[model samples]
Structures are given as structure tokens and as C-alpha cells.
Target: MNPYLEIHPEVQQALAAGKPVLALESTIIAHGMPYPQNVQTALEVEAVVREAGAIPATMAILNGKCCVGLSQQQIEHLGQAKEVWKVSLVDMPYVISQQLDGATTVAATMRLAAMAGIRVFVTGEIGGVHRGAQTTMDISADLTEMGQTSVAVVSAGVKSILGIGLTLEYLETKGIPVVTFGQDEFPSFYSRHSGFGSPLRLDSAHDIASLLHTKWQLGLNGAVLVANPIPEPFEVPAPQMEWYITQALHAAAQQHIKGKAVTPFLLKYIAEHSKGESLEANIALIKHNARLGAAVALAYRQF
Candidate 1:
């Protein structure tokens, strides 16, 4: 066992018993959402996972421990805590060594989930190539981590605020398969359609499980991106999302928000501008992904 890893008893038991276990990221609690809603959504998502017949292991860092499954109290603390370190791949070691309260980004979560032997991960959205990356070169570490980590990520697709097309291209270049669930078109986080064809498509948890089994059986490395679309009724229209994103981007620039701070800033901006509709959409998609992740984890265990 890794000394740095503090696996919750429930998660440990599930893993040892060969039962399904779904890994969930914690950035959503620490920096992604606001106040009581963040805590509420975190608890709700865990329930969704458990209802699907799997254990939910929410990953975070607290007081130098790499916590695999946080309790409800820890979730609330992370949600209300200010200035929590949004730890990614590069910052993970520093946060742990320094005993800082840290939230795991997609990259950090995937890395730690793989370390803890959890194969399926759920998140609202995976970061990607930021808009105008040619000059700024502001690609997210999530992409790089996906290219190496072996966990299967269930998400609503890349944030619409990013270059979705470029993100797909980058994933392809990295030899990471991007499989859309029950859809031929790639989703755009808040929207159901990104106007791009997905590289692959799978309709059921069994299909995804089989694909993952085959891939790893052939000695393939890296993560499988399961792009689960946001539920249609909850989806914000592409045009409306585009407008909101543009407004948010302009404001980010004006405020000089850069680096890791950019995403949380933009998400809050969009939520506020959309009159909390975006936040609702975000919570909905994450819970939806949690269900799928649990199902996939169960199916994977069969192989």
C-alpha cells in the first residue's frame, strides 16, 4: 500500500472484495462550485454512484494525506474552505509534502485513482486546449494525464469554453480513444453537440466495459474518455453557451485571470451570467456521469 494514500475503509473493502468502485474528482467541491450547492451535489453524486451498485471514492488531499474517499464532513469542509490548493499533476507532490488542503483536478484525480487501483473516474468536464492556444499555449494537464493514466474517465465532454475540436485532435494524437455514449456526435459540456464526429461510440456500459477490457488486454496504456452528453432538457443551447462563453472569456482577459485560476473564474462567471442555469446543468451532468461510471465500473469488474 502507498504510504501517502489513505484509503477509506469502504473503498478498501470494495476493492479487496472485487466489487465495483468508482473514483470521483474533488476539484468540483473545492473550487468548481459555490457554497451549499457544492456540498449538496457532492453528496448526491455519491448516492447516485452507490445506487448504481458501486462504491464512490472521492479523492482529495487533507493534512498531507492523499484521501481516497472523503466523508460527508470532509466534503463540506472542502466546499466551504477558501483558498484550497487546486492541485494538478505538477502541484500534487508539493501539496502533499507541505500538508496543504488540496483539491484534485482531472489530471491529479486520474493519476491518484489509478494509483489506488480505481479504474473508472467521474467528473463534470475534462479540461482541454484553452482557446487561442497557438500563441498562449495554455493547454490543460488533463489531456497529458489522459494520455498516460489508465483510468476510464466519464465526463460531459470538454468544457465548451475550450477548443473542442482541437481537444479531440490532441486526444487522437495521444492515442487516447474518445468514445461517446449513446451518440455519434461529441458533446460540448453544457451542450449536447460540439458539431464534431466522435472517434468512437458505445451504447451501453457492457460495450464500454468490453472495449476497455480488450484495450488493456492488448497492453494498451492511457485512459479511455467516455464522453457522456448532458441530458437534453438540461442542456444549454450551443448558441447561448457560445455567447455566454465569449462574454466570460472577455471578462477573464480584462481581469487578467491566467493559469489554473482561469477555469474556476470562468465557470463562476458563466453560472452567474446564466442566472444559475449553468450551475444546474453542471450538477445534472455530473450526477448523470456518476451513474454511468458506476455501471461501467461494475461491468469492468466482470472482465
Candidate 2:
């Protein structure tokens, strides 16, 4: 009878029990990884969340409504479908009104997660100000959404391809706290160190949850970005990824690629040029982030 969302029975049960539930974005299935592997990684991430004692809710847009948790068949189809729309916060109205199929980006996912009463969201990276944003005047809607939404986003960090320094500054200006887990440095998506100090660091999930609790108790809007670095063995060396990023940026300039097309193109180029290391690191970090996200949700439940 819920017109706004198609809630999976398992997720509904978890909600009824007051158990922790972690929200997952669907873009990673639709636009992030290759077909079979995308589905496989999605399942693996859910398994990790379950192992951490939280329910997983993968969100997508389907049949003119937000789907709070997709079935495995739907997940597989989303992973392989080339026509899946990249649904962001702005895209929700179109997807709903037009009755189109779509996958939720970080901003959209956060909105849907909150609709489902889910407080924690897991993603490989959250978008921010693009490189050369002063000239391009481009910024992701995710940043603004984080400034106003009440959800906790767990990510490795922003993608290395973006201007992380500006992103951090922008989040600070918007009053969104950026917290890194067990480290002084924020992480690059494909590597361990992003070369910038995190504004705050907490050694444990309980500490992070307490901060989130205090923020809400004080009636502050906006989300907290919890940066959990990928394990050392799983990360690519920073200098090595930098070379690939530089080369990809040059190629983008040569081809005059701009706007949203720029990110996918550069990522694809790096994936191929790095002999698929970027994609491998991506999978590893996503799984790592999912585990941390579920842990955060669990701690939040205790609070």
C-alpha cells in the first residue's frame, strides 16, 4: 500500500525488529562495474553487511517508485542493463513521473534511505567539486544534499579523479563534518592516502556514532561523511595512480570531454591503461566500505 516505495519483505521485517539496516546505492550495479562482476560484488557486499549483523537495503528506481530493496533478479538485471538511467536527486521526479527504470546515485540513495528510515549509506565514493571547477563551474548535487540530509555516508573517500581539497573545503563551508576512521589522512578511492589531513578522526565506530548522535540531538541538518580507508594490501600505490590520472586528464582535454561524460571516460581509460587495477581496487574498496557502513549502522542503533 506504500506508493512511494516497494519495500522488500526482509527489510520490512528488519525495520519491525529495530535491527540496524544499511542502505546501498544502485549506481554501482548499473553504472559502476562490469556485468557479472557487478552483481557478484553487490552480493558480496550484502553478505559482508549481514556478517556484520545488519540488514542490507539496495535502492533503485523501478515502476514509478523507489525500491527500498531489490530482488536478486532485479539486481542482476540492473547490473547488466545498459539503459539504466543514472538517477540522482534531481532525476527522482523524472524517474517517478515518467515511470522509467533507474539506479540511485549517492544523493538519491541517501534520500531514499532516509525515506525508509535508514540512517547509514554505503558507497565507494561520494561526489564533490570536480577538478577545474572554478572554470567549469561544476559541482555535484551530492555535496549540497549532504549539507541538508540526515544520513551517514561511508566511503573510502572521494574519487582520486576529483579535486578532493576543494571538496573538503566545500563540505566544511556547508557545515558537514568529515570524519576519517582510524587515520589522520583521508583516503583516495584507489589508494590509501589522499595527501590531505582529515578534519577529524575517530578510532572506533562507537565514537563516530556518538558524534552523529550529538549532531542530531543538537538539531543539525546534513550528513556526516565517514571516510574509511581501504586496507593497505588492497590499495594501489598513490604515485602509480597519479600517473594514470594525469594521462587520463590529458586525454580528456584532447577529446574535449566535459561534464558527466568526463568521469566515466577517464575511469574507463584508467581501467584499461592500468591493466584493470583501478576496477580491482574499486571492488575491494566498495566491499570494505560496505562492512564499515553496516558497523556504523549497528553502532547507531545502540545509540
Candidate 3:
């Protein structure tokens, strides 16, 4: 056990008993949504995992401890706090050594989850090759982390704010398998289609679990990117959402938002401008991913 890690008793017990456990990121709670909605969604997502028969370990950093699971009060604090650090892989050491409150991004959460022996991690969507990376050379660390981390990440898909085609290409270059659940077309976060074919497709949790087992057992290290589509009723059409994303991206560039600040800024901007349609879609997809993550974890444990 890592001295700096503090696993929740429930999560610890579940691990001890060889039960399925799903790791969830704290970035969604702290920086992804508005106050009350963020807190409410966090709790509901956890409930979804438990209802699916898996323990939910929401990862964060609090007072020098790498917390594997957070209390309700802690979740609320993260949601409402103004000074919480948006901790990514590079920010982990600084946040922990400084004993500050920090929300874990997908990359950071996967690292913590792997440390605690959790296999499947759930998040709304993942950061990927940003738009205009050809010149700016800007890309998210999440992709690099996915190339090495063994924890499987279950997400709606690459965030529509990014270049989905380039992200898929990058994942291929990294030898990271991108598997879409129940669809041949890769999803674009808020939308059910990305105009790109999925490199791999699996229709069932048991089949995905088998793939995870086989990949790792064959010494193919790194995370599997599970693209779970949002429920059809909640999906925003690709064309409309793309227009909104273009507007938001322009806003981000005008404001000179760079690095880690870019993602949250784009997400908030789109949600506010979309009249809550995007926000609702975001919430729905996270819950959807949580359900699938739990089912996959349960299936993985069977092996």
C-alpha cells in the first residue's frame, strides 16, 4: 500500500473480498458542471455503480493523501470550492506534496485507481488531440497516459471539442485499442456519431472484459479506450453540436485559454451557450458510462 494513499474502508473491503470496483474521476465533479448539478450528478453516478453491483471509488487528492474514495461532504466541497487544483498527471506530485485540494483528471484518476488495484475507470469523456494540433502541437496528456496505464477507461468517447479523427489516429499510433460499445461508428461525446469507424466493437460487457483480460495477459500494457455511446434520446445531433463546438473553440482561442484550462473552459462555454442541452447530455452520458463501467468490472472479476 502506498503511504500517501487513503482508500475508503468500503472500497478497501470490496477489494479484499474480490468484488468488482469501478474507479471514477473527480474532475467531472469539481470542474465539469455547475455547483448543485455537479454534486448531485456525482452522487447519482456513484449510486448507479453500486446498483450495478460494483463499488465506486471516486479518486481525488486531499491534504497530501491520494484518496481513492471521497465522502459526500468531500464531494460537495470539491463541487463548490473555488480554489481546487485541476490535477492532471503532471500536477499530481505538486498537489500532493503541497497538501492541497485537487480534482483528478482522467489520467490522474487512472494512475490512482491502478495504484489501488481498481481496473475499470469511468469518466464522461476523455481529452484527446485538440483542434489545430498540426501547428500548435497541443495535445492532451490523457492520450499519453492511456498509452501506458493498465487501467481500462470507459467514456462516452473523445470529447467533441477535440479532433476525433486525429485522436483515433493517435490512439492507433500508440497501440491503444479503441473499442466502441454497441456501435460501429465512433461516438462524439454529446452525439452518437463521429463520422469515423470504430477500430473495434464489442456489444457486451462480458466480451469487453474478455478483451481486457486477454490484452493484459499477453503483456500488452496500457489502457483500453471503451467508447460507450450516450443514450439515443439524450444525444445531440452531430451537426448541431459541431456548430456549437466551433463557437466554443473560437471563444477559447480568443480568451487565450491554454493547457489544462482549455477543456473545462470549452465545456462550460458550450453548456452555457447550448441552453442546458449539452449539460443534460453530459450528465446522461456519465451515468450511462458508470453503468457500463460497473458491468465491465463485474465481468472482469469473473475471470
Candidate 4:
């Protein structure tokens, strides 16, 4: 009942009843995909979470209030809304103060999820150290939030446009646990392989839940990253995806797109150049993560 927060009744009940609840980000609806598809995917992901035995709480900002779960109408409006702010930690205050609509990035989502006592979050992928970040000092706020928050994030992986090696190293320095699900090799968001071995791998939701429980029980702080690979049929081969990413990155550079604009710009470029295949892969991976997130939340409830 805080003035700045609004929790949907279902999500509130789940929290009060100790039932499993999975938190989802809103940037995927507002800035991550095209209109109808964004709305469609949002609905589908919610359905997947419910089927997997949890309630879905898709977080966003509406009229300056942080909303923990969006209704169907709100989801549609968000997907079609104009000039919605892509909100991260730094943008939260401004968006709220201005009474503007805002889509929650991974960082913003994690922060709000922690505020609402929701421990499991699902998203398409995470932002990471941008390529050439050594020169630009442009690492994403998502990494910083991971170091400070307690939510467990289930994502496809780091967005492939980023410097994966550097991002992983930064995570190591911050002591964030990155655990790959089912595979020993970490995934690149659009593809099943990143050619980099994961530092840790847990094959099932129960195992992931156990790890999370133990970490918190031992008084460990910060988030747990669960990298879930896209299903094989939807995965673009690593080599092919790398080529597409290169083209998209170059295009972003040519357009002088940086900061908050970089990811959506790069994703749009890849989606267009790849004849919509990349978008398909993106949607598929989100659904996959939603399922895993729900399972992990359910299992964690028992801990």
C-alpha cells in the first residue's frame, strides 16, 4: 500500500499466501520488440509462468507509481505506448517524478522486485559491458544491480552485442554467481553457444533453488544469474549469429547510438538484417526463461 508502489491483487495474494511468484521486466514489451508481437509475447510468457505453477508479475511504471503486475489492457497499452522511458536505476526517480510511463530494464526490474519481495525474475537477456567499454567506460547498470540485489535472474544470457569476456570478468570481480542451466557452456542470447564455458552449471530447477537457498542462508548478498539457453530449433548457430551481431554493431556505431539507445538499435538492426529470424529466437528464449523462472520460484518456496 505504499504510495509509490502498486501490486496486482493476484501477485499480492501469492506473496501473502507464500505461493510462488515470478517477476518479469517491462522493457521487453515497451522497447524490446514490435507492437503486436510484444503484447502477444508478454501474454504468452505470463501464460507459460502460470502453467509452470507460478503467478507472473510484469513490472512497469504507470503515472509515477511502480506497478508490480500489469493487467492485459496495460500490457497492450505499454506495447503500443509512445515515448515510454526505458528506466534503469538512474532513470527511476525522473520517470516517477514526471508521472511518465516507464519500462523497467533488468536493473530497474531487479530493484523493484527486491522491493516487492519477489525473488525470481525472468527476462530475454541481460545488458553487459558494451564492446570497447575499456575506452568508453560503458558497462550496463544491470551488472551493478546484480552485485547489490537479492533476486535470482533467469535470462537467455548476456546480449551477444556486448563484450562477453569482459562482462564475465567484471561479474567475477563483483562476486556475482553465474550459473548456466542444463549446459556447461554459457549461451549467447540468440544462439545456444557462446564458445565460453560457464563457471558453474546446474541442470535442474531444484538444483538452482538449492544453490540460491544455501547462498542466502549463508548470508551472501546480491543476485544469482541463471543462464538458460534457447531451444535448439530456435537457436541460431554461433558463427552465423556472430556475423549478424557484427553487422548490427557496426550499424550502431555508424549511427552514433550509445547508452540506452544501443541495445534496441542493435536488436532492430539484427532483426531486420536477419529477415526476422533473430526476433523469433528472442521470443523463444524469453518463453524458455519464463518456464524455468516459474519452476525455480516454486522450488525455492519450499526452501
When superposed on Cα atoms, how far off is each prediction in RMSD? 0.6, 1.1, 0.7, 0.8
Quote model 4's TM-score.
0.99
Please report, in order, the local distance difference test score of every candidate based on alpha carbons.
Answer: 0.94, 0.90, 0.94, 0.94
TM-score of each: 0.99, 0.97, 0.99, 0.99
Candidate 2, which segments miss by more than 4 Å at Cα?
A: none
Clashing pairs in 1: none
Per-residue C-alpha lDDT of model 4 across residues 1-303, encoded as one tens digit per residue:
567899999999999999999999999999999989999999999999999999999999999999999999999999998989999999999999999999999999999999999999999999999889889999999999999899999999999989888989999988899999998899998888998899899998999999999988988899999999999999989899889988988888798997788888988888999999999999999999999999999999889
lDDT of 2 by residue, 67-180 (tens): 998889989889987778888888889889999899899999999988888899999999999889999888999999999999999999998989999999999999999999
Tens digit of lDDT per residue, candidate 1, span 81-182? 886999999998899999999999999999889999999999999999989999999999999999988999999999999999999999999999999999
**In model 2, what are the clashing residue pairs, if there are any?**
none
lDDT of 3: 0.94
The alpha-carbon deviation from the true structure for residue 298 of candidate 1, after best TM-score superposition, in angstroms, is 0.7
lDDT of model 2 at position 272 = 92
Better of 2 and 4 by lDDT: 4
TM-score of 2: 0.97
Return the TM-score for candidate 3, rounded to 2 decimals.
0.99
